[model samples]
Target: MNLFRLDASILPGNSASAQLADAAEAEWTAAHPQGTVTRRHLGTDPLPADAWALATTASFTPEADRSPEQREALALATALAEELRSADTAILAVPLYNYGVSQHFKTWADLVIAGSDNPTEPLLKSTPTVLATTLGGGYGPGTPREGWDHSTPYLERLLGDIWQAELTVVKRELTLAATNPAMESLRPLAEDHHTQALTAAREAGRALAGI
Candidate 1:
């Protein structure tokens, strides 16, 4: 089996999202000891900001008139799309930043769409995918920040609806409780969220392996 993993945490060393992804990945590895993993860490090695723009422009330009930069961008975009198209399964560890998806991930997604053979077609049709996400504050119904999380819904639409993947999300909120004095009272709930997310991640991983 081939597994594709993507990490988007700016703080890789102390990332809550990565923690859950680790649990899921560990289970997948245990099941498929001989499987190959393709890894990409956007935080450490981000894609070029202009690549998507160049690629999109190239699509409209005739092949013979494409510039060197455009050609390179197109190649990078195609490679990114191929990663999803070729993967048997995938795991994405993305954290909410500023109440929405990070620019790094948005760029990646745009490039993938620009590079696809058919933009309307789902690249990961029926593929099993695990999405591990974390939030620093609580966004549940009674919280002040309720309905403020703009990240998870976008992820679901892009990966599940657009890519047509069978996606399972493992989410942990209130991650800042341990560090922020203002959120000290939420520590207990944060711990609980952490534990539940880990369990869900492992279960998602096991299901991916079985698929």
Candidate 2:
């Protein structure tokens, strides 16, 4: 099985999203000891700033009439699409940035969702995908910041709504509770949430391995 993994957490060692993703990847590796895994660090190697605009323009222009610039743009999008098309299973690790999606993730996801110039072929295929996300604050219903997680809804639209991929979301919330003095009272709960998230991630990883 081929596994494609995307990491979008800017925080390196301290990123909860990355941590959970690592756990998931480990499980996949264990199950498929000889399988190949492709890793893309969106936080560090983001899609070029101009990639989306170029690709969008390319999508509209006829292949014969498209300029070299447009062709170049379309190629990038095709490459991203191929990654998803070729993968048997994929993992997307995204940390909620400022209560919303990361700019890097948005750019890459946009290109991946936007297909190549071919009208007949779909851009992204439905692959089993694991979404590992982290929220610095709690956003569950009845919480102070309820309904504040803008990232989750948009991600659902992209992975579940747009790509039609089988998705399992493993999230760790209240990551800042243990460190932020203001949220000290919630530290115990935060620890529990972290433990649960790790277990879920590992289980999801193992399950994906079987698929």
Global lDDT of each model?
0.93, 0.86
Residue lDDT tens for model 1, 31-89? 99999999999999999999999999999999999999999999999999999999999
| TM-score per candidate | 0.98, 0.92
User: Which segments of candidate 1 are over 4 A away from where they belong?
Assistant: none
Q: How many backbone clashes does candidate 2 have?
A: 0
- Candidate No. with top lDDT: 1
lDDT score, residue 121, model 1?
70
Please list all clashing residue pairs in model 1, or write none if there are none. none
Candidate 1, backbone clash total: 0
What is the alpha-carbon lDDT of model 2 when measured against the actual structure? Answer: 0.86
